[model samples]
Target: MHMHVALCAVLDPSEMPGGYRFEAIENLVLSRLDRLPPFTRRLVMDPLGLDHPHWIEDPEFDPIHHIRRVSCPAPGGSHELGRLVGRITSRPLPRDRPLWELWVVEGLAEGRFAIVAKVHHSAVDGMMGAGLMVNLFGMTREPAPEAPPPREEEHPVPPEPRPSDIEMLKSAARKRLAQPRKLVDLAKRTVERVGGVVERRRDPELAHGGTPLTAPRTRLNRPIGPQRDVGFARLSLAELKAIKAAVEGAKLNDVLLAVVGGALRRYLAHHDDLPEVPLVATCPIATGAGRGNNNVAAMFVPIATHLAEPEARLEAIQAATRGAKEEHAVLGKGELLQDWADLAPTTTFSVASSLYSRLKLSKHHRPVHNLIVSNVPGPPMPVYLAGAELEAAYPMGPILDGAALNVTVMSYRGQVDFGFMVARDVVPDVWRLADAVAPAFRELRDAVLGAPSEASPERSTPAE
Candidate 1:
């Protein structure tokens, strides 16, 4: 999967010092590079393809290589900016360099600009990606104080020369030699989890997280092309929290998923393609231990898109999330998934993925899930980069081959920013789904808290 994650931030340059200048912004970001690790590291794959890739400091690391400048076309609006972002994300990061880039895009309307930070998924996951953005754009207008020294575990040793091929092979072999013990442990855990599943199935009160390949085939489950389309949506964090408080047993995430389900229902019904059964979403659950690593597990959740009423959908989503979490815990959270990955040969996965795509195997089988929905927490207060105020920040996650759409949400300041990334050919009118999010939220809010005295001011990037 040539997947990368990104955050597209639209800046209000009114507060910027001397307005927007590409060189000024570039220098500012370079000055703060010490705070980021992945900015200077390049991937080094195992020669025998027996192990996961290792990251090492690039001897020829240059800030200018990763930092770039671009100009938005005329009538610079959200749609124009999104188009720019789509083009940026379509390309893969070169392995010869550190897998990241920060584009300082100028020429936005009202003298606004944007920063699109793209990083390879191999270097960072949702948590680390969000952290990198925050660090890049400090909390205030001034340059941040010298970042404290990284803990020993964060960067145990100073940068060293690249390991020789023989050295890498020996390290890979050592890990392979220990795999039998890992396999035995994995088998034991698998048996225990199987028993747990059986026991849970016997309990009437227990709910299931749903299984893979059970999702109904829809227009969304198709092979994706190289091109991408993006859309933006915004929700008030306070309003979401209010609804969470009003509804019994409802968490913020449940409310968020309910909004997505309602939006999907509207979008699909508009297309006359609404499925009779509820749609399943592959929700990425964080494992909490690996702060800077891709420590995540998948939980398939029934989004209750078939439910007509907003409150009913919210209630169903709350219960579904609970069930998913329970099942996830039963599966040892992410440990089981990580163990299996560690035991498998890395090349086997690469070959299988290549074959799957080459043969168009997705059409021959039920889709694994409908789409990927990820929730990432962002800074609570206003953040600035080089003296520019961040108006809106949309976090984008990579879409898969079968599931060609990804909806990633981030709560920044008081607004929850939704980034809808879809394969251009699969969901060309992604703007419709993006535009539906607010109305969906309003319907849910009214259903739970009753009508408000006045309409809440809608805040969103004006994407076409």
Candidate 2:
């Protein structure tokens, strides 16, 4: 039930006067705490059984507890940093405090440093997380001090009174009493939506989107343990755009999926586990509205890994994603899913999730999807943090019980960085899969560009 979204960003060493210092980093974090949105300081769940879980200000909020400094082993490189991140991600955030942690890591080779930020998925979606980063970071290497606007002397506003447990229970009971009518309304809307979706599917031109429960099972789709592993890869955004230009109606996302398909094909073949059928990926699409977090719906895209030729795989992925997008549009921005989720009993959901984990029920059924593949666009220009130039950023999403692999790609500056999180026992050599992405993109580049000159290795930062 603890789903956390984490991201790591590498910073240029030259921007800082002798690289990053713990004192300076701590001071910067403390200074920005007051400027953060109020939600960042809130904790969820009520101590009394009065109302459903809600956010309240953390009475004992401590800045030092949230921001920390860590160091890597000597000759610190991507491998050490990635291993540290894996360990950090495996640990659940403390429930009694705000659900976010930021680690300022030093000792990277060549005097470089990294910042790893983890926040509960309940607090922010991918888009909101990126927005928070932009807020905390600076647009320039030497950002001017934020000045508070001058205000005339006035009486301070009084603090609002907190609701009593009895009052909260009364309000909740009233809402519960209305559930029957709400359920009826929801049922009617769901039926109408399903009918509309069916009508769209009946159209011959819009039938390519595959049906649910049709995804082929693979090693990646199985029950997972609590432990996890993470790896990272970087690709040239320019090359991805170039490949997209070569194919009509192809987008950056389509090219990324094709590249991932190629990489998965190679990795699975090496392990003698390549499936005859194409692998399916659940791509999370933003609904653009929610409580400001978890505002996403998902679509299943068939990654044409079974196709031998890179060009054919790219083309198949493009068509598959196009159909998925159309299907998502017909579904109307995931309103149905959200509506049902809103009515779900919180205690029942928590108990069910815990039981499912303990019983390992993920292994009992056919997989709904093989893995999660998400793409989030990041700042096109370089960003700075406390005077350090940000070099690269990689986002890591949560791995579910049935889906052991989560691949998240973020485009920053001129590069597309890929973060892979996997079940430690299932994918011990996850770095191999990450390393395969570079050559996979190269193969696609050769297919699209017509010539096979040496692809620039500089475009990639493979985990060692």
Candidate 3:
């Protein structure tokens, strides 16, 4: 049950070649360097299969046979990287090769390196994704000491490739001509859906989170093109926590929400386009609970930033967030049968997404709710690669239609790493947005916790 999880980042391309030589924590990770393709061209996804198990290993019977690097040449640079990632992510995994790829990018103005990683979401999640980096990177700057054998065994050979790409295209055409059952299946699915939503109106839980299907339109949730913009920001855990402590009932996450609210407000205000009303930040809800798979729901809470006072804004946000949580809690307590009954119509991913992007979109979206923000907590303790201390860690999430920017925070060690990703064309000035995050955090700190002044730290990376 591996979900095809893929995410991208842009870096100082100049440092890529030298960085490439500075090996990953393990020796088994491969580098997939190649020229990038245009947006229209399709990427080749190596088929992952049962024999493959989506795991890789060296000759020895050790696990940790992951970490491949994919590099596309210069001239294409950052923009090209976007198209390459889009080409990679838009397609499903092929069932043969390992289920992940780390595109180590090169060719930039500064000595920086960007890495695009794709892993089956099933194999890794937001929490696990950050841990893997720390586990794989050494925190120490010193030369490597003697190492031991890997913790796992070698991976088995992959299964045989299915019908070749050409053959598959031909097969698809044949099915188009002869498959009426495809249409029938869809029709039956639609009628069954109609019956379910009608009955859900009476269910207590489904009735809790009002209009769970309707999401507001935001600049971030737009129909993104091939272009993308990536930026970074960070805050100390102490500072963020202080803000939470000041608020009467604020959770650490509420601090995160307030900071994001401030950042987005600043970003839109810079353009003289700040929404007079509050913006709705849609946070993901775990649909499967303990059961895994891509099962996820969302809670979109209104964040108040229109008021110039940052404290008031945080207080208002905290209240709104509490309400959202209450609603989700009620939804979670419903009986299993009620869940199925209430969720059947919502089970289809496209129904609500389409409504938000197209007709009948929410008022929050019409003016565009600032941006979508999510904070996923990670291990606070330092992790080692064979024994190298892990450094900075960043987390990213997918951008949906109508929303042009998505701000995701992953807390590692004592720092919270923030990533600001925008659709290139929609938010060409993403770096400014990243810059805004720090000041916003400070504003929350001063008003809420009365903290002192300090410089915002730079993102740390493992040294070669």
State the TM-score for model 3: 0.63
Please list the residue runs of candidate 2 whose C-alpha ends up more than 4 Å from where it truly belongs after superposition: 17-19, 46-52, 143-162, 452-457, 462-464
lDDT of 1 by residue, 258-301 (tens): 99999999999999999999999999988875633677778999
Clash totals for all models, in order? Answer: 0, 0, 39
Would you list the rank order by lDDT, best first? 1, 2, 3
Task: Give the local distance difference test score of model 2.
Answer: 0.79
Report RMSD (Å) for each prediction in the order shown: 3.4, 3.6, 9.5
TM-score of 1: 0.94
Give residue 408's error in model 3 in angstroms. Answer: 1.1
| Backbone clashes counted, model 1 | 0
Candidate 1, which segments miss by more than 4 Å at Cα?
Answer: 143-158, 453-455, 462-464
Candidate 2 lDDT over residue span 230-305, tens digit each: 8999988887888899899999999999999999999989988888988889898899765445799888899999
Q: How far is candidate 1 from the true structure (C-alpha RMSD, Å)?
A: 3.4
For lDDT, the strongest prediction is 1
lDDT of 3 at 421: 60
Arranged by TM-score with the best first, the candidates are 1, 2, 3
Taken over the whole model, the C-alpha lDDT of each candidate is 0.84, 0.79, 0.53
